[model samples]
Target: MTSIAAVTLEVADVAAAERFYSAAFGLGSQVRLRASEAATTGFRGFSLSLTVANPATVDSFAASALAAGATSLKPVTKSFWGYGGTVQAPDGTIWKLATSEKKDTGAATREIGEIVLLLGVDDVKASKKFYVEQGLTVGKSFGGKYVEFATAGPSPVKLALYKRPALAKDVGVPVDGSGSHRLVLTGTDAPFTDPDGFTWESASSLTPAP
Candidate 1:
């Protein structure tokens, strides 16, 4: 079994990224990497998603992220799937906050119930195959458009792949150009890139439990 133990972002200012994420999402400081400003350009090819227990929590978190300096990519609204919105963190990482359940009133907390790393891949089939070879078990999949993988243990973050254009459209972003996705997946044995150039890194500390 395999799990995306963590999703690390390469940012221009590690300290700034750490501050924003902690203030905006209550995430800890371990998920950031310091890199040159040139590291972020063009489409990142992926987005981070936060799943809460209800719609009120979704809106609360979205508003908090904006107040904490994130750019709103999409506003909170009711959709076929649920209520949610997209925001770009200070370091160029796009985040989606959503929940299927609806609640009329409640205060939003910095705490998140779950997080998923969504990859926008050029070829879903190829990317799926690559991860499968790396020992990740498939959870749910649709023809050439979306696929979900099972988490190996108590991993906080889940992983999924969707067609690039569809992903970009969902997040209200353009799908063009080549640059670092600013994403890194640790807990694997070696570093590698998928079909669309999303990189993954291996860290022994992140290895999943048996």
Candidate 2:
């Protein structure tokens, strides 16, 4: 299985945007230039690699993306949690950027690891059965319509299921199935939402405990 590492975002200008992030979120000064013109920047634990593109290229991509139905939003500003940004793709896909310093070391260093996806299912029973057949051990039921599933492998990932309506109430959101939810578990794990709509979380501490 192809496990996820870090989600990369296409930014306007590497240095300017990076500076903005650093000042806005107090990010670290560490920045690395890849073989390409792109630069990889790091914060405390997570990293943001700004791939530089020519001005013309950026304009062209933006135009093409907007033409294809993409809507771009300003990056995430100061929030109760941290700093981040957002963008809507041509296919109505949404992307977010945030500065996370937490690292996933273990139980001693962190609690939950990797990304946690809250999925809304039309049929909880059917979805639960499908995941169970796939080898995932379903954990305790949160309530009547919510449950937790844990899988052990190279990287531990958690899949939390909630009734669409129930999840909305828990998160205090209107509950749009198409919305994106990004989460950082523990300290080092970088779990993110995949383009295919399946939430993916990766973590070293996610393995089962003895």
Please report the candidate that would top lDDT against the real structure: 1
Q: Write the per-residue lDDT of candidate 2 for residues 51-148, one digit (tens) a residue.
A: 11222322333343344444555433445544334444422223233334222222221112243344556667766775555445776575448777
At residue 45, give the lDDT of candidate 2. 16
Candidate 1 has an lDDT of 0.79
Off by over 4 Å in 1: 103-110, 205-210
Score candidate 2 by lDDT: 0.38
Tell me the RMSD of model 2 versus the true structure: 14.8
Best candidate, TM-score = 1
